[model samples]
Target: MKTWILPALGTLVCWGFWAFIPKLTTRYISPMSAMVYESMGAMVIGAIVLAVLHFRPDVSGKGIFLALATGMLGMAGGLCFLFAVRSGKVSVVAMFTSLSPLITIALGYLLLNETITLKEGLGILTAFIAIYLFSAS
Candidate 1:
Protein backbone atom coordinates (compact mmCIF):
# COMPACT_ATOMS: atom_id res chain seq x y z
CA MET A 1 0.00 0.00 0.00
CA LYS A 2 3.03 2.26 0.04
CA THR A 3 3.44 4.79 -2.72
CA TRP A 4 6.45 3.05 -4.25
CA ILE A 5 5.52 -0.55 -3.63
CA LEU A 6 3.15 -0.99 -6.55
CA PRO A 7 5.51 0.50 -9.10
CA ALA A 8 8.44 -1.42 -7.63
CA LEU A 9 6.57 -4.69 -7.86
CA GLY A 10 5.39 -3.83 -11.36
CA THR A 11 8.98 -3.20 -12.40
CA LEU A 12 10.06 -6.53 -10.96
CA VAL A 13 7.48 -8.48 -12.92
CA CYS A 14 7.81 -6.44 -16.12
CA TRP A 15 11.58 -6.73 -16.18
CA GLY A 16 11.41 -10.39 -15.25
CA PHE A 17 9.38 -10.95 -18.39
CA TRP A 18 11.39 -8.43 -20.42
CA ALA A 19 14.58 -10.31 -19.61
CA PHE A 20 13.18 -13.57 -21.00
CA ILE A 21 11.53 -12.18 -24.14
CA PRO A 22 14.68 -10.64 -25.64
CA LYS A 23 16.57 -13.91 -25.48
CA LEU A 24 13.82 -15.60 -27.46
CA THR A 25 13.72 -12.71 -29.92
CA THR A 26 17.49 -12.56 -30.51
CA ARG A 27 17.33 -16.15 -31.70
CA TYR A 28 15.73 -15.12 -34.99
CA ILE A 29 17.29 -11.71 -35.72
CA SER A 30 20.41 -9.69 -35.21
CA PRO A 31 20.63 -7.21 -32.34
CA MET A 32 20.31 -4.24 -34.72
CA SER A 33 17.11 -5.57 -36.26
CA ALA A 34 15.69 -6.40 -32.86
CA MET A 35 16.51 -2.89 -31.66
CA VAL A 36 14.72 -1.34 -34.64
CA TYR A 37 11.56 -3.27 -33.88
CA GLU A 38 11.90 -2.53 -30.17
CA SER A 39 12.19 1.18 -30.83
CA MET A 40 9.15 1.06 -33.05
CA GLY A 41 7.18 -0.54 -30.28
CA ALA A 42 8.35 2.13 -27.85
CA MET A 43 7.39 4.85 -30.30
CA VAL A 44 3.90 3.44 -30.66
CA ILE A 45 3.52 3.43 -26.88
CA GLY A 46 4.81 6.99 -26.72
CA ALA A 47 2.32 8.08 -29.35
CA ILE A 48 -0.56 6.68 -27.33
CA VAL A 49 0.67 8.45 -24.21
CA LEU A 50 1.02 11.69 -26.12
CA ALA A 51 -2.52 11.32 -27.43
CA VAL A 52 -3.74 10.82 -23.88
CA LEU A 53 -1.94 14.01 -22.84
CA HIS A 54 -3.63 15.83 -25.79
CA PHE A 55 -0.29 16.01 -27.62
CA ARG A 56 1.09 18.64 -25.28
CA PRO A 57 3.84 17.57 -22.94
CA ASP A 58 5.62 19.82 -20.43
CA VAL A 59 8.49 20.28 -22.87
CA SER A 60 10.94 21.64 -20.33
CA GLY A 61 14.57 21.96 -21.33
CA LYS A 62 15.91 19.88 -18.43
CA GLY A 63 13.16 17.28 -18.80
CA ILE A 64 13.76 16.98 -22.53
CA PHE A 65 17.51 16.53 -22.06
CA LEU A 66 17.07 13.86 -19.40
CA ALA A 67 14.42 12.07 -21.45
CA LEU A 68 16.72 12.01 -24.46
CA ALA A 69 19.54 10.66 -22.34
CA THR A 70 17.28 7.97 -20.92
CA GLY A 71 16.23 6.91 -24.40
CA MET A 72 19.82 6.79 -25.60
CA LEU A 73 20.91 4.71 -22.64
CA GLY A 74 17.95 2.38 -22.98
CA MET A 75 18.58 1.83 -26.67
CA ALA A 76 22.28 1.24 -26.20
CA GLY A 77 21.66 -1.13 -23.31
CA GLY A 78 19.03 -3.00 -25.29
CA LEU A 79 21.36 -3.44 -28.23
CA CYS A 80 24.08 -4.73 -25.96
CA PHE A 81 21.72 -7.08 -24.21
CA LEU A 82 20.49 -8.44 -27.50
CA PHE A 83 23.99 -9.13 -28.73
CA ALA A 84 25.06 -10.61 -25.40
CA VAL A 85 22.10 -12.94 -24.97
CA ARG A 86 22.72 -14.35 -28.40
CA SER A 87 26.15 -15.61 -27.42
CA GLY A 88 26.00 -15.93 -23.64
CA LYS A 89 23.85 -17.56 -21.04
CA VAL A 90 20.75 -15.41 -20.57
CA SER A 91 20.61 -16.05 -16.83
CA VAL A 92 24.26 -15.20 -16.30
CA VAL A 93 24.09 -12.11 -18.47
CA ALA A 94 20.96 -10.97 -16.71
CA MET A 95 22.58 -11.53 -13.34
CA PHE A 96 25.63 -9.51 -14.26
CA THR A 97 23.70 -6.74 -15.98
CA SER A 98 21.30 -6.31 -13.10
CA LEU A 99 24.20 -5.12 -10.98
CA SER A 100 24.35 -1.92 -13.01
CA PRO A 101 22.62 -0.08 -10.19
CA LEU A 102 25.96 -0.06 -8.39
CA ILE A 103 27.01 2.56 -10.91
CA THR A 104 23.89 4.54 -10.15
CA ILE A 105 24.59 4.34 -6.46
CA ALA A 106 28.15 5.54 -6.82
CA LEU A 107 27.13 8.38 -9.13
CA GLY A 108 24.35 9.40 -6.81
CA TYR A 109 26.70 9.51 -3.88
CA LEU A 110 29.41 11.50 -5.67
CA LEU A 111 27.29 13.84 -7.79
CA LEU A 112 24.16 14.23 -5.73
CA ASN A 113 25.70 13.66 -2.32
CA GLU A 114 23.24 10.90 -1.64
CA THR A 115 24.51 9.19 1.45
CA ILE A 116 24.71 5.43 1.51
CA THR A 117 23.83 3.81 4.80
CA LEU A 118 25.83 0.90 6.16
CA LYS A 119 23.03 -1.51 5.24
CA GLU A 120 22.93 -0.37 1.62
CA GLY A 121 26.71 -0.48 1.43
CA LEU A 122 26.67 -4.03 2.66
CA GLY A 123 24.04 -4.89 0.07
CA ILE A 124 26.19 -3.41 -2.66
CA LEU A 125 29.23 -5.30 -1.44
CA THR A 126 27.26 -8.50 -1.35
CA ALA A 127 26.04 -7.88 -4.89
CA PHE A 128 29.57 -7.52 -6.22
CA ILE A 129 30.70 -10.65 -4.40
CA ALA A 130 27.74 -12.56 -5.81
CA ILE A 131 28.56 -11.34 -9.29
CA TYR A 132 32.14 -12.48 -8.94
CA LEU A 133 31.19 -15.88 -7.57
CA PHE A 134 28.39 -16.34 -10.10
CA SER A 135 30.57 -15.48 -13.08
CA ALA A 136 33.51 -17.53 -11.90
CA SER A 137 31.55 -20.70 -12.42
Candidate 2:
Protein backbone atom coordinates (compact mmCIF):
# COMPACT_ATOMS: atom_id res chain seq x y z
CA MET A 1 0.00 0.00 0.00
CA LYS A 2 1.07 3.53 -0.60
CA THR A 3 2.46 5.15 2.54
CA TRP A 4 0.32 8.27 2.20
CA ILE A 5 -3.00 6.48 1.92
CA LEU A 6 -3.62 5.91 5.61
CA PRO A 7 -2.76 9.45 6.61
CA ALA A 8 -4.83 10.82 3.74
CA LEU A 9 -7.80 8.79 4.81
CA GLY A 10 -7.30 9.87 8.40
CA THR A 11 -7.35 13.47 7.21
CA LEU A 12 -10.54 12.83 5.27
CA VAL A 13 -12.27 11.46 8.34
CA CYS A 14 -10.97 14.00 10.86
CA TRP A 15 -11.63 16.93 8.58
CA GLY A 16 -15.10 15.61 7.80
CA PHE A 17 -15.74 15.99 11.50
CA TRP A 18 -13.76 19.19 11.68
CA ALA A 19 -15.91 20.78 9.00
CA PHE A 20 -19.09 19.73 10.81
CA ILE A 21 -18.30 20.33 14.47
CA PRO A 22 -17.66 24.03 14.04
CA LYS A 23 -21.09 24.75 12.58
CA LEU A 24 -22.60 23.00 15.57
CA THR A 25 -20.41 25.14 17.83
CA THR A 26 -21.35 28.49 16.27
CA ARG A 27 -24.98 27.77 17.03
CA TYR A 28 -24.39 28.33 20.74
CA ILE A 29 -21.74 31.05 20.75
CA SER A 30 -20.19 33.88 18.81
CA PRO A 31 -17.63 32.93 16.18
CA MET A 32 -14.82 34.51 18.17
CA SER A 33 -15.87 32.62 21.29
CA ALA A 34 -16.16 29.43 19.34
CA MET A 35 -12.66 29.98 17.95
CA VAL A 36 -11.29 30.46 21.47
CA TYR A 37 -12.70 27.15 22.64
CA GLU A 38 -11.61 25.56 19.39
CA SER A 39 -8.02 26.66 19.97
CA MET A 40 -8.15 25.21 23.47
CA GLY A 41 -9.32 21.87 22.09
CA ALA A 42 -6.41 21.87 19.64
CA MET A 43 -4.00 22.72 22.47
CA VAL A 44 -5.14 19.69 24.45
CA ILE A 45 -4.31 17.49 21.49
CA GLY A 46 -0.96 19.21 21.08
CA ALA A 47 -0.21 18.61 24.74
CA ILE A 48 -0.81 14.90 24.31
CA VAL A 49 1.51 14.79 21.29
CA LEU A 50 4.18 16.58 23.27
CA ALA A 51 3.91 14.06 26.11
CA VAL A 52 4.06 11.17 23.67
CA LEU A 53 7.19 12.64 22.18
CA HIS A 54 8.66 13.11 25.65
CA PHE A 55 8.50 16.87 25.20
CA ARG A 56 11.06 16.68 22.45
CA PRO A 57 10.33 17.43 18.85
CA ASP A 58 12.90 17.48 16.07
CA VAL A 59 13.50 21.11 15.26
CA SER A 60 15.54 23.87 13.72
CA GLY A 61 15.11 27.61 14.16
CA LYS A 62 13.93 28.14 10.59
CA GLY A 63 11.65 25.11 10.72
CA ILE A 64 10.20 26.30 14.00
CA PHE A 65 9.56 29.74 12.57
CA LEU A 66 7.88 28.29 9.49
CA ALA A 67 5.77 25.94 11.61
CA LEU A 68 4.66 28.80 13.83
CA ALA A 69 3.84 30.88 10.77
CA THR A 70 1.79 28.01 9.43
CA GLY A 71 -0.16 27.87 12.66
CA MET A 72 -0.83 31.59 12.51
CA LEU A 73 -2.05 31.33 8.93
CA GLY A 74 -4.28 28.38 9.81
CA MET A 75 -5.75 30.21 12.76
CA ALA A 76 -6.40 33.24 10.64
CA GLY A 77 -8.17 31.11 8.09
CA GLY A 78 -10.06 29.33 10.86
CA LEU A 79 -11.34 32.61 12.19
CA CYS A 80 -12.50 33.54 8.72
CA PHE A 81 -14.17 30.15 8.40
CA LEU A 82 -15.93 30.64 11.70
CA PHE A 83 -17.36 33.92 10.52
CA ALA A 84 -18.26 32.41 7.18
CA VAL A 85 -20.09 29.48 8.73
CA ARG A 86 -21.90 31.80 11.07
CA SER A 87 -23.24 33.86 8.18
CA GLY A 88 -23.35 31.43 5.27
CA LYS A 89 -24.64 27.96 4.62
CA VAL A 90 -22.09 25.48 5.90
CA SER A 91 -22.65 23.32 2.83
CA VAL A 92 -21.56 26.07 0.46
CA VAL A 93 -18.94 27.48 2.81
CA ALA A 94 -17.32 24.13 3.38
CA MET A 95 -17.33 23.09 -0.25
CA PHE A 96 -15.96 26.42 -1.35
CA THR A 97 -13.24 26.52 1.27
CA SER A 98 -12.28 22.95 0.45
CA LEU A 99 -10.99 24.21 -2.88
CA SER A 100 -8.02 25.72 -1.06
CA PRO A 101 -5.88 23.04 -2.63
CA LEU A 102 -5.99 25.08 -5.83
CA ILE A 103 -3.92 27.69 -4.07
CA THR A 104 -1.46 25.03 -3.00
CA ILE A 105 -1.20 23.76 -6.53
CA ALA A 106 -0.54 27.22 -7.82
CA LEU A 107 2.12 27.84 -5.21
CA GLY A 108 3.76 24.50 -5.85
CA TYR A 109 3.96 25.25 -9.54
CA LEU A 110 5.13 28.81 -9.12
CA LEU A 111 7.53 28.51 -6.21
CA LEU A 112 8.64 24.89 -6.12
CA ASN A 113 8.71 24.26 -9.86
CA GLU A 114 6.29 21.38 -9.44
CA THR A 115 4.97 20.28 -12.76
CA ILE A 116 1.26 19.88 -13.34
CA THR A 117 0.57 17.26 -15.94
CA LEU A 118 -2.19 17.73 -18.52
CA LYS A 119 -4.51 15.54 -16.45
CA GLU A 120 -3.78 17.52 -13.31
CA GLY A 121 -4.35 20.78 -15.17
CA LEU A 122 -7.67 19.49 -16.37
CA GLY A 123 -8.50 18.48 -12.82
CA ILE A 124 -7.79 22.00 -11.65
CA LEU A 125 -10.00 23.47 -14.32
CA THR A 126 -12.75 21.02 -13.47
CA ALA A 127 -12.47 21.97 -9.83
CA PHE A 128 -13.00 25.63 -10.67
CA ILE A 129 -16.05 24.81 -12.71
CA ALA A 130 -17.40 22.68 -9.90
CA ILE A 131 -16.90 25.51 -7.49
CA TYR A 132 -18.88 27.84 -9.67
CA LEU A 133 -21.69 25.35 -10.03
CA PHE A 134 -21.66 24.53 -6.34
CA SER A 135 -21.87 28.15 -5.35
CA ALA A 136 -24.62 28.91 -7.84
CA SER A 137 -26.94 26.40 -6.24
Report the alpha-carbon TM-score of model 2 versus the true structure: 0.97
The local lDDT score (0 to 100) that residue 62 gets in candidate 2 is: 96
Off by over 4 Å in 2: none
Q: Give the per-residue Cα lDDT of candidate 1 at 122.
A: 95
Q: What does the lDDT come to for candidate 2?
A: 0.92
Q: Indicate which candidate wins on TM-score.
A: 2
Residue-wise C-alpha lDDT for candidate 2, range 14-123, written one tens digit per residue:
98888877888899999899889989998999999999999999889999999999999988999999999887889889999999999999999999999999999999
Superposing all C-alpha atoms, what RMSD in Å does each candidate have to the true structure?
1.0, 0.8
On residues 10-95, what C-alpha lDDT tens digit does candidate 1 reach at each position? 99998888777889998898889999999999999899999999999898999999999999998999899889988998889999
**Which 10-residue window in model 2 sums to the lowest lDDT?**
15-24
The reply for model 1, stretches above 4 Å from the true place, is none
Model 2, residue 53: C-alpha shift (Å) = 1.1
List the pairs of residues colliding in candidate 1. none
